[model samples]
Target chain A: MKTQTSRRTLLKKGLGSAAAAIFLRAKTARSHNIKRYPNSCGVLVDMTRCIGCRSCEAACNAEQKLPSPALPFDDRSLFAQGRHGSKRRTDENHFTVINRYDPPEIDHPLFRKIQCNHCQEPACLSSCFVNAYTKTPEGAVIYNPDVCVGCRTCMIACPFYIPAFRYSSALHPQIVKCQFCYETRLKNNLLPACVEACPQEALLFGKREKLIKIARHRIRNDRDRYVDHIYGEYEAGGTSWLYLSSVEFDQVGFDTTIPHEPILNSVKNFLAMVPMVLTIWPPLFAGFHLLAARRARAEKTRQENNREKADEDV
Target chain B: MKMFNPENVHLPVSGSKKNDGSPWSFQDKVLLGLTPRQYLSQLCRNRVNWLLVLIFGVGIPLIVQRYFYGLAAVTHGSNDYPWGLFLGFGLFGMVPLSASGFLLGTTVTLFGRKDFHPIERLALLNGLLGYFFAVVYLLVDLGMPWRLAYPMFVSLGPAAVLFLVAWHVATYLSVQIAELLPALFEWLNRPAWKHYIAKISLGLTIAGIILSTLHQGALGALFTYAPTKIHPLWLSTDFQWIHFLCSAVFGGLSMVIISSFLISRYASWRCGKEFSSTLHDITLGLGKGASYAVFTYLVIKIVAIAHDNEWEYLLTAWGGYFLLEIAIGVVIPLILFARGVRRGSVTTVRWAAAIAVIGIIWNRLNVAIYCFNYQLYQEVPHWKEVWLTVTLYALYFIVYRFIVYRLPIVFTWNKQSRKP
Candidate 1:
């Protein structure tokens, strides 16, 4: 039994060393690649130029072929009561909704269109377990309904609350969100319907890098007309949709306080610990068990030896 | 039922019957020593049954209404507050409370603490039921509950934190069931099955530890995806997972302590002498462990706040609420647990455990629902949503009571010891 136990320990040690070597090699290879998406397409929304016409909303609805709203797109009353002190948001039926925010100091109400910001490193994409969501090089955060399990974790995980579930359906429920016109417009390298329909030319479409240059140029060229900072330039590790506002971005319905780093980076701290615990805990705990068992074995042996001595004396 | 010799019939006091040489039927096993009439009488006599029946009566219809009419039918249908009580109470509240199984398993099996062995099965049972019901709550809340297997067999989201949570929870649930199988085998007079399970016990325990660690931390990591939304006081990029994991250690232990107290007080008939006698000692031991965990949690929480330099937020109302959660959930429970352990006062410890359990639930709810998007107006859950949450919890209670009444969780099956 002792020989067998020793042999097993030796084998485990050999396997452990081999695994360590392989893991180290893999870590080095992973560090070497460090890939980043460079040529992604993006949109820049200039809030100063947008009129609360709801034209973008109408265009998005028509383009997506979504169900008609209970209120007509022309109904201005819908903008009277905004959502949670912001503006209207994306839902299962509506991929994009324009919201009106009236700043106390400003004479005119500002319109900010809400949809999937199409984040460069989207939380929804990272939070999906089934690989259901994809951030295409065309700069659209698209979802595959076929793989979604209705876990709603993505809904919980999304900072913008962009992903909406078709909860009413009993048989074939799926997540509904804006795909940035990936199928009809983005695939053909054409501007999204929302951008095309905006009569004020409030929305601009181009490569993300080029869009950043245009946004900066607008801000630098006419300093008083636009906010100094681009809304999506650093928020949540930048997004495909950039925003330039006349008033403070927060005043115009943008979440200005979101961290610059990708949200997944926060979670990775915990994830990195998982494999370490799995590898280290078993052997460590098992070793403790062996040590405890050894003491029991030694005690039993001593008792047996003493009993034999006592029997001989008798 | 077939008369195994009285000496060989290793049944609890209520489990035995005067068998007249026939195989025991499922009904006979369920009835145990009670006559069919007596069992029926007991079932009808319980007041809890009427409450459950009423909940199902009302809630089932509402659930159906939800499906037919849409989330708008049963809920206020606020797009702003997408998640309501179903998630707040069920998923967030239950998962932490269920942490007892892995914690206790580590103590008894890995650490060789034989004194805790008597109550180990109860802890396992508590963990299993909590997780099972959490999933049940998930089903009720999910738009397409039937497609739950999509993440596993159909779609793969390897990058998602929730993906890890779903896979790990499913895997851990299986692991927990496997861990509890030995008790079931023992009760069924299957010594061979018991031996086989015992042989693989170490492997299962390690797996439970690993799976529990990831999923429990994953639950917290799920919140990391909403970094800006969750209040900074509760949100810690570096310490969020650790905070969740540490809290669960005590949260699970406290749940076991609370459950044991309830069993000893209300259902003593179901528990054998071995369980009842050793329970108080185990409770104290568990309290000691809980105190240590709570202390660590408190320190890490402070470190998290300090790390982020969020000291100024303490002056705000949100900060006050955060401090209140810490005070009630961490400080008060820690003090109570410590005092109870020092005084060897089982009653005091039990009360502390109950408080800790409630405190843990409150903290989780605060993180998931209340403190979430703190800058925005607070979302009050819809009436139907609240009702649905209560209905699910009632179901959990019924299942727990049913299992405790029959399973050899608190009591050992006498037949196994009688054998060679």
Candidate 2:
């Protein structure tokens, strides 16, 4: 019995070690290749310069050929209107919305525009099961409606809660969000419609690296005018869109709790365990099956031998 | 069924032939060896059938309305909450409950526990149906039900956690079907098919373990993708997968116990003497196994909260809610399971199983819906959405009953009919 137990232990150890070696090799060869594109262009939204003009909103609506709004873009009443004490979010009807926030700390109401940040490693792109989302080299996190199975996992994954499903369409429901005008404008090396439409130069489109330098330079020159920290510099592993604000970003509807790392970082541990389970479970369970089967066979043989000996004695 | 099952009654067909020795046709087997009128009469006699009819009568039209008028017409269709009761209750909730298939498979086949043989097929059927209905719920909730196979065939994203979930679930569903095929082959009188499945049953069981481990964990890993969205108490990125996997151990077993207890009470006539006599011992044995799993799950859940340094979150209102969930869902069930198994009280164990089943579903709902977007306002599901979720569950119950009644899941096939 002692010898049999040792043999079983040895077999289990052998299988475990072999599986570990394969798992280790796979782990090294594939250590989460987080694709970071250089020379990607981005938008720098300096909120101090914006006059709360609805020009960008109207420009986006016309540029995207979206349905006209119930109240015209010039209407200021939309700012006061909200659902569940929440400000207007990007939905299928609207790609980008500039919300007016009246913080008590400051005397004036600060107008903040909300849209997709288009992260360096976009959560939507990472979480999409069909590879429907794409973070192009040009800094746009575009979505392919053709390939989308519409599982809505992307919506759950987005830290900023930007992606909204077009629930009205029974046949062709798809996620609607700001794409930086990737197909019509960014692909042609032109500024996005919203940036081009900003009459006060509040929205600036340039190479992401250059934009970061310019944003830093502006903060260094005028410390009192803008917050020292750039909103998207490292949020969610650095979005393509950066923000300079007068007050703390959270006071004006920003999600301050977003981690500095990419959303994929949260899931990487489980993803790492996947290969190990796929590699090890089969051999481990099979070894158990073999041991149990062998023990059962041995018990049967021993019972038969004892019965035969008793019969001879009789 | 009880009213219909007389001592000399020829209904509730257990074998391929009548007592007079004429072979029952396929139709007769489906009707349980009763005439069409008798079958309809028996169905109408049961009050449960009337309840089922009422649910489906309202539910089927709502389901059709959902597809025709779009999700916005039925559900709140809020952009903030992309998933509602359907995925929360149906997919996440049902998948864990379905884990009984692999757990029992590993026990009876891998560990060679022949005493559990009587309940193995029933567990497998439960697992299979739970998973099958989860997909049905997916089909209903998904925006594009037509493209369900795209993840499998058209395109692939191997790096995503959901990709792993999709592939493993699809593969595991087939593995479960193959594992349960022997019972179907026995009912169909195809000895050849049964023999072939038996030869490869070990491989299939091993495959079941591999797929079940990855996907069950993957379901929890799905929440990890939204670390900031879900409350800290519910979301521990490092331990989320293990939390899901560990809890499923008891969740699946508890579901089996609940189903088995219900069957013993309501459908005793369907159970053979062997199944009926051994059921009490089997319940005790299963209760013991479930208690150990619940103990492990409770420990890990505490360990997760500690590892994430989330004790501070417990002091808030959310913390109070979290503690309530732990006490009612985890602690109460664990204590009941332990006490029940120790005292040899099957009734107490059954009660524990029932609470555990509801508790597990409640936990899944909390993680997916209630605690999700913790800072944001809660998104209440529409009444139509709730109706649809309950409707799908009723459909699941019906499918389960239909199969258990017809298949040799609760009872052994008569040996005399094996050759014929």
Please report how far candidate 1 places residue B386 from its true position, in Å.
Answer: 1.9
How do all models score by TM-score?
0.90, 0.95
Give the poorly placed runs of model 2, Cα more than 4 Å off.
A1-34, B415-420
**What ranges in model 1 sit over 4 Å off?**
A1-38, A83-86, A298-314, B1-25, B67-70, B416-420
The per-residue C-alpha lDDT of model 1 at residue B311 equals: 99
Instruction: Write one digit per residue (lDDT tens) for candidate 1, span B1-420.
Output: 113224335333333222333344457666655568766776777777888889999888988887777666777655556677777789878998999998888888877788999989899999999999999988877767778887788877676777778888899899889899977775565657878788888888888888888888888877887787889998887888888889999999999998988888888767888999998789999999999999999999999999999999999998999899999888999999999999999888888888889988998888888988787888888788888888878888888987887778898765412322
The deviation in Å at residue B406 for candidate 2 is 0.9
Per-residue lDDT tens digits of candidate 2, residues B283-302?
A: 88888898898889888888
Interface RMSD, every prediction, one decimal place: 2.2, 0.7
Q: Candidates' lDDT values, in order?
A: 0.82, 0.90
Per-residue error (Å), model 1, residue B189: 3.4
Candidate 1 versus truth, CA RMSD in Å, comes to 6.2
